[model samples]
Target: MKLVTYRHNGKTSIGKVEADRIIDLPRNDPALPDTMLALLQGGQDTMARARAVRGDYSVPLSEVQLLAPLPNPSKFLAIGMNYRKHVEEAARVGVQTPPTQVWFNKQVSCINGPFGDVHLPAVSDKLDYEVELCAVIGQRCRRVSREDAASVVAGYMVCNDVSVRDWQLATQTMTVGKSFDTCGPTGPWIVTPDELGDPHALRLRMWVNGELRQDDETGSMIHDIYAQIEHLSTAFTLEPGDLLATGTPSGVGVAMSPATYLRAGDVMRAEIDGIGAIENRVVAEPV
Candidate 1:
């Protein structure tokens, strides 16, 4: 089942997506709560209750505003150059692929919903887009084993990890380049892990203004999702609402022969199989 957080009547509420319409989850359900994260924190039982929800409180597809699947996560970690092709592309630019997983943090303020506009920040001119498979944690755990890591995942969503190449390269760390407000665009809806088994086998693709840029399968990932979780959990607790970007494939603008970068008025669309797509326009901010 596809789950979503939406705004209607100027208020945000949790809903389930069914047949292109949103089946609004009733606030007064005896079992499940109203908020998306709360429902997730309630674990599998709440999911069962949400699945049993059946009603036509659903609104038309075009009627309401869809918000980020998890509005504010406790932590947002990203794996860098985990795709083989992306690593190869990075090698061309002198950024070597790591033997272990390369991880970084994205400020929560960077998060934005699907169909939002991403600002080309005045501080940098080399904005780039990365299409990646991202997952949200369902349960809290520290030092989780690889075998138990996948079970802790609540759901998956498509994320565009917008980067400022210049800012990223100067510091040798991606946090600054990756944390611009509105840089991260995620969600049309979140697909529960049960519905999207084998996260590593999905196809991830990205387009810049209708031109296909990155097109590779998650099977190409150097360090797959479970490994990433185990690796990260060893260092920090994976809390409920924690988000992880599983990394991107090759075909980014910076790796192109001519080296293209996004400018004001450009658009980007990213999609992953099972999880839907997210599209965002580029607009200039005042310098």
Candidate 2:
């Protein structure tokens, strides 16, 4: 199932994607939750209900505004230097690969829609983009083994881990730079685990303006998603609707000989083969 959160006619609701339209789930069954987070928390039966719903009210893809599929997830985390090539690229920018999984928190407030605008903060001009496959947690679990990890993942979405290179390098956590408003752009829709067979074998790419700048495959992750889940869950509970940005591949702007940072008016298109694409335009930060 491809699930989406959208706003139509000034009212926000969750829906299931079918072809180019969104099946209005809440409208079909009044018992259904109106938000993606609530539906996930409703557990398996709610998902089953979402799958079974045949709604007469569906909005054409172009007619409604698609929002971030899971906007208010409890945790919005990402792994850094998890791709060997990206590891190599990081070294060029004076950042090294961690001997262990390096995780960072992208505040939930940073979440933006699939086709939203990314802010070019007045504090920095070193903006960059990283295309990653983001996993949405389906159930609450702890100490999940790598083999059991797939069961806990609800689905996946394409994300642009938009960064402010200067601020990112300024602090070790990479949180402040990563947590800027509108930096985490994800969705188009979430593709359920069953619908997306292998999470690690998809092609991920990002383009700035009209030029392809980053290209790689999910199979290239050094730590991998399962290891990430197992490692993180070991320390705390993994809840439904939480997001895990698996990692991004190389060819980022900061790695270029003459670093190419994004500016206002730049359009970034981030895509994953099985999930979909998200296009965000860079705009000056609103004061």
Candidate 3:
């Protein structure tokens, strides 16, 4: 079942994706709840209800807006250099790959809708784009075992971890470079865990101005998603609606021989197999 959180007519609601259009779940259903977070918090019972819901709502998908699947995540964790090609490219740029996962916080304030626009911040001319597969946690987990990590997943979504290279390099930690407002763009649709078999085998790709930049399969990931989850859960409790932006593959603009970067008016699209694509345009930040 593909689940989605959408807004129409100034009201936001949870719905199921069918035939590329979201079918509104009845608010009075005994099993399903109203909000995506509530449905996730309800666990399997809510999912079961979401699966069974049928028929239509008042709004057609064309009239509605798709928000971040989980707008306010308990934790917005991102993995860095988890892809082998990305590692090699970083090395080519004189960046070192850490022995362990380079996890960083992408503040929830940076979250934007699937079709939203991302700003080419005036503060930094080194803006870049990262196409990634993000996992949405469905259950509360602590010290989670790698063997059982898949069970805690709610779904997957396409994400663009937009970065400002200058701010990111200024700090030892990458949060400042990563957490600019509107930096994290995700959605189009969330493919439920049941339908998106083997998260590590899917293909993720990204394009800038209609040119393919990053094109690689998740099978190329060095540490892999399960290991990333197991490693992260060991340090902190993973809760429902928590998001994990599993690192991007190689072919980023900054890694180019001439080091290209995003400019205002450039449109970026990131896509993952089974999970739909998300697109955003680069625009100048308001003065």
Candidate 4:
């Protein structure tokens, strides 16, 4: 089932997507949780209930303003240089591939709706895009093994890991550069693991102003999702509603010879097979 959070009648609600219609869960069953995070924390029982719900009260997809599947994730983390090609591209610019999986925090404040506008920050001129597949945690767990990682994942979504190249390279943490407001664009909706099948085999592509920029498959990840979970859980508990960006492919603006960075009015479309796409436009930071 594809789950979404959308605004209708000026109020936000969680719903399920069917074709071009959004079946509002709360309207169908008053007992259901109204928010995505709350519903996720309810676990399997909640999901079962969601599955049993019928499309009694639904609105056209065009009528509601779709928000990020989970508007407020508890922790928004990302893996870096997990793709061999991307790592190789980094090496050309003097960045070495890390011996172990490298993870960074993308401040939750940076989260934006799948179709929201991305701002060309007035503070930085070197903005870049990284198309990645995002895994959404279903249950809270720590010290999970690679074999058990699949059980903890609820769904997947497409994400654009927007970066400010200058600040990222300037900092040791890479948090500041990755966490700029409106930088993290994710959604369309979450496709449950069962529906999505193999998370490792999806195709990921990114286009800027109608020009193809990045193209690769999820199978190319060096660490893969299960290994990443095993690695990250050893350090901290993975909570429901937490997000993990699986890392991007080889082609990115900074990797280009002349560095073709984003400018105002550029439309960036990031798509992952199975899980829909998000199209965001670049605009000058608002005053």
Specify the highest-TM-score model's number. Answer: 4
lDDT: the better of candidates 3 and 4: 4
TM-score for each prediction?
0.96, 0.98, 0.96, 0.99
Across 1-287, the per-residue lDDT of candidate 1 in tens digits comes to 88898998897888888787888886535466778778888877888889988864678768899988887887888999888888898899888868788888999999999888999998888999999999889888899888988889988999999998898887866798889989889898889888888888899999998999999999998888888889988988888888899999999989988889999999899999988899999999756
Q: Is candidate 2 or 3 superior in TM-score?
A: 2
**Candidate 1, number of clashes:** 0
* TM-score comparison, 1 vs 4, better candidate: 4
Rank list by lDDT: 4, 2, 3, 1
Model 4 worst lDDT window (10 residues): 93-102
Better of 1 and 4 by lDDT: 4
What is the per-residue lDDT of model 3 for residues 171-202, given as tens digits with 9 covering 90 to 100?
A: 98889899999999989777888799889889
Give the winner by lDDT.
4
- TM-score between candidate 3 and the true structure: 0.96
TM-score for predicted model 2 compared with the true structure = 0.98
